[model samples]
Target: MAILPRSQRLALAAQASARPVSVPAPITGWNARDALDEMPATDAVLLDNWYPDYSGCAVRNGFVLYSTGVDSSPVRTLAEYNAGATRRFLAAAGGKFYDISIAGAAGAPLASGFASDAWQTVPFLSRLYFCNGIDTVQVFNGSSFASASFTGASSLAFIGCIQYQNRLFFWLPNATGFYYAPLNSISGALAFFDLAAFAPHGGNLTAAVTFSHDGGNGVVDFVAFILSSGDCLIYSGNDPSNVNAWSLVGIYRISPPVSPRAVCQYGAEAFITTYDDHIPLQQQLVALKLGQLPPRSKVSTAVQNAVRANLTGFGWQALYYPRGRRLIFNIPNADGTFSQHVQNTALQTQPWCRFTNMNAYCWGLFRDNLYFGAAGGVVYQADSGNLDNIGPVAADARQAWNTFTDPMRKRITAVRPMIQAVSGETVSFGLGFDYGDINIALSPTTAGAGSPWDISPWDTSPWSPDAIVDPRWRVGGGTGQSIGVRMTASANAPTVWLRTDFRFEQGAAL
Candidate 1:
């Protein structure tokens, strides 16, 4: 008689596949097929959207001011007024900007000569700059609200504005160029300088952001511009006026059909969401760090199919919160809700999570807090409480690990799941043998107090080891060449799939 191995260990690693159609065979090392409706990190809770229907958001003086969406009958806007004795919140609606400082406070037209109610506001240089992409830029200083005047040009309209290197840069949609005001100057009398002539490539300038870092010579200033044609241009220099001094450092190409507002800078890296032209409607979330080739990894593939099915044109938004080390993309769904794909860059273990039930239109990071505005003049802070949406919503985290197969045919007797979970948390397991020919449900396992944090006596708490739960069923005398397991958790508890141990009887080759 020859002795045979009694058990085998199968590790769950890299659960990147989320689409059921793309689920890989368990024999491969690919860990999961889906992790939606849950957080990206291992054993973390899924948080819901905080507020209701706010369409726009901006952070000022430690408060998140939200504005109503344009879909409503009368558009509403929110702006902070801190000029002189007027320290209040202003509301703009019904084709007019009003001073809604106090409840019942008589509404008055915005003194800034804002002719239209549609405006996107951003705070920079001690003032709030407002633009509707068509009208002249409006600024609300601490003292007064007024329209900005540019030298040589009677009226200046820009799609977006960003403050970098003490200078105000605006994206010129009409001329496919970029114009900037003097360094640290926000006065209406300053002349706007054009950088289009100096730019290397010719294309519609969709977005621009500055990146500063200490280099060989000293602090090097670089501005990255994204073109409508999916080309990225980088210019290096400290001064924008000295056109000759600013040299083109690098250029990279990305998939076109991307949103102009979906680009964000994280450290020295820029993350953008775009669709692959080669693949029909295949969306990808890519990252490009300064001085490096574009990364080939599509971090958003976990929900790529779902996003492509629901995303509308190039209207999505991307935001990065440094404190949480999170990169969030808000993609509009056809159902009027929004699908927020959150990536935890902080934890390299598990980096993707898809969140739903929230319809955030805009996001703002204020004082290390993440704030978002939804559709109906509502705003909420993220990571504030455990509850998701508005009520106690249960988490729906699920994963299907790779299949386990023996070199020769075998009879699977039982499976022992080694899971680390919070006390009282239950994890359900589904077993499929012989490439899913025979499917069976294993007895659910409830984890014990597996960590010191789960028990009392905080300082003196002992670390409890993990408990391996063995299924009682013998697979109904199931015989197969391979086996796979799928696990799911709906409770708001932390869970981590360490590995699964399989006990089987060896048999002759088929």
Candidate 2:
């Protein structure tokens, strides 16, 4: 082969140039990695109020009027008691519990004078039992809210409780064992079961999570007692008081929970929110034995660096909303503010997302619907409509950098965020260069003046059906080796993101 001159080769390479490439929008959800610039193109660098979907990122549903003005203090907990066809929703705040079933100002305090704000509640035998580590175990029997009549445990102030094997079990703070009542008996003398002997790490029991496991031979229900030292004692039995009926499964040490409320049960599997990660208790055992990462570490691996400071923060809790198929983990800050790390479990990958402007202190379910207790004396029904209460939802997303493995710098010239909007919506377009957050201020969004550029022409498309795709090309300008497109919108009408086209020059030495 004949050798080409250096100038000729350079000229040929320059002439070939690089073409514009379009990439599907990120749907694998928010990735708060240490090196966000290195994340996959399908993962979001910063995503809020938008859920990851297989087709694209979709706007989240909003909250509506539930109840408010319970007290000046924060509404710490929301609970429900369902008996047959009737369901009653209750709100707790300022050391008092109120009946807030209807949408209005909370009714008078149903139960008052409690010391702690946190309460562990479980519904059993047509009534609900509560434990707060400071107050006597309170029982809400649909009408009355008062202390239980357990004869033997009158002096015990239980911190947490769960219904396992047909018994109401209670545990105290800084104690290795727990208290349980006889089977099928809600009001009776309680029996003490000591776990100090079986637990290996010898730490106090923090919480009990009840779930079922299927190991090829049908499903088996188990209650997992989580120790503060990360030791978990799982038991399978109906009667703990009977030596022959009760038995210990195994004691495995994993990441301890941030709080007693950090464990969330979705269907049959329970997810434990620990200092380092959110993983299933069953998978944690297998991962520990096989020396592999828990399959669901994706929940925390993406936000490990971001959540490291919040592992010990207050108001850390997880709740599963079956109506919306969302698994929400509440992360509170030192300033009394909070954000939610939510996952859409309906999706196969169970993609993650972050939610803002919805500062929920705790979550509860009533009539198979989701509701959350808020900071300023209120309870809002979440996943109800297109707007977050009254204000619009601020949907923001930052796509991973699109470098295409090129070492040379590039300049992004334009971006087209295919959005399906009702009527016409405005979306701000900003471009972040290099590897960090974008610095360019987005220009005002203007609707397309000309005919639509999609498959169907203007008149033929469904007129004002729900929403239609707007193919307006946004003019963007930035210079860097990597370019990440940031799309932001605050609208009452929810929208969908289809894909993005990054039109740019490949080699710009300047």
Candidate 3:
């Protein structure tokens, strides 16, 4: 693998007049989408769960993060084995905080803690709601917790439940229907909404619940839930008549080996996740993109069609979209490596993957690389050429002709000469800056044709004269700002003897 001289490569870039290549600015950002600042002390490690909150990144403080086991319990908090980290916290019955993070090993006590036995779930909010049993429900506020009493009625005990919009709902194991509360609304103090009329038969217990805004169009909102039997159900939020009712719009029966975990709705499409263990670990991606909801049906076939169409391929999983960037997907390979792909490109292609010993599970996008949390509390970053396709590359190409205001200073758009790799043995590029100045850099890659070699005429004119300057052009106006050379690629040409450099600048000046 011989390295090509930058001079020769410069010429090759311009051999063609019609086919021009424009480099893209790379995609760059931070790591860990759900990274928490001011993490708790190491000794006091607790179970962590990410919930959808309206306030962007402010789900903590106001909400309680709990731990299931105690460090003192030998069996529960053994020194080895992930520090006994399988903790689960949920809004449990009787407003008690269910500490499920501890390992219920032999000879280990439940671990002593404040209000552990007195409260079933911790009080993270002013009001608490949970299912006491099948056909029984309870609501407890500060008053209820103090008095050890509830004001709601008992309804069918739900096998599983979740709360949204301040109302809690549950499902019956049989899936025949759903029972909602407060079962007994005595006077006006307690409230109850009977959704028995809206329940769908054969609907198993829902394992997950999520909602999606209607893409900000005010068309309709969405409610999606996954059942234990691996079935998915979706409903439209536009039915003003049945505000609490959910119409079964559509269903997907994924059988034989895939367990769906997360569900997200984008626009009118629903993305479902399947657990995988392939080389790079496959995440079975299934989508449902919608066209229009059915007239009288609870579920919309339009939505189902959209999902099925998007899930047309296997071995694809859509990561949660990064806040500032477009949708970048992780395409997994057989060797535990993955590439990030941009859906916005016509070349909806995935990046190339090269294994680097351990797997690179992308936690976040940084500058031009993906950052991963390694096995032993160490962090690693990887560059898979994802940046070459976007970000800095594109910005670099655009900067050649457009005026780039120093991002740190005032809003001054400066343009310069477009760097064009010239013809000859020693090919060089002329960079015209928006300020009428010229600069150059060697192309590190390929060196092209046209063999005269000497391009001295192109180099000395650092800034072109005013008479020849295009009236539309303006003078570049800054010192710290880039007015000259940026980057260059070159190659060796035996016949011609010359070294060349290319430069980009704002536009011609005034």
Judging by lDDT against the true structure, name the best candidate. Answer: 2
lDDT of 3 at 266: 40
For candidate 1, the 10 contiguous residues with the lowest summed lDDT are 51-60
The true-versus-predicted C-alpha distance at residue 332 of model 2, in Å, is 0.6
Off by over 4 Å in 2: 1-18, 299-313, 405-409, 440-466, 508-510
Instruction: Encode model 3's per-residue lDDT on 1-510: one tens digit a residue.
Output: 987788867545433221222222111111111112221111001111111121111000111111222222111001101113222322121223223323231122222222211111111224443332332333334222222232343434434444433334455444533433332321122334333344343345444344544446764544445554444455554332365754555554332112121233344444443322111111121322333321211112222332344433222333334342233333334444443332221112211111122232323322323333222222233322212212211111111222233322222232222222222212222233333444444122222322322245533432222112111222223432322323222211111111111222222333
Q: What is the C-alpha RMSD of each candidate to the true structure, in Å?
A: 9.9, 5.1, 19.5
> How much is 89 displaced in model 2, in angstroms?
0.5
Superior by TM-score: candidate 1 or candidate 3: 1
What TM-score quantifies how close candidate 3 is to the native fold?
0.31
Ranking by TM-score: 2, 1, 3
lDDT of each: 0.50, 0.79, 0.28
Candidate 2 lDDT by residue in tens digits, 145-197:
97888877646689898988778899888999989988888888898889999
The local lDDT score (0 to 100) that residue 117 gets in candidate 2 is: 72
Clashing pairs in 2: none
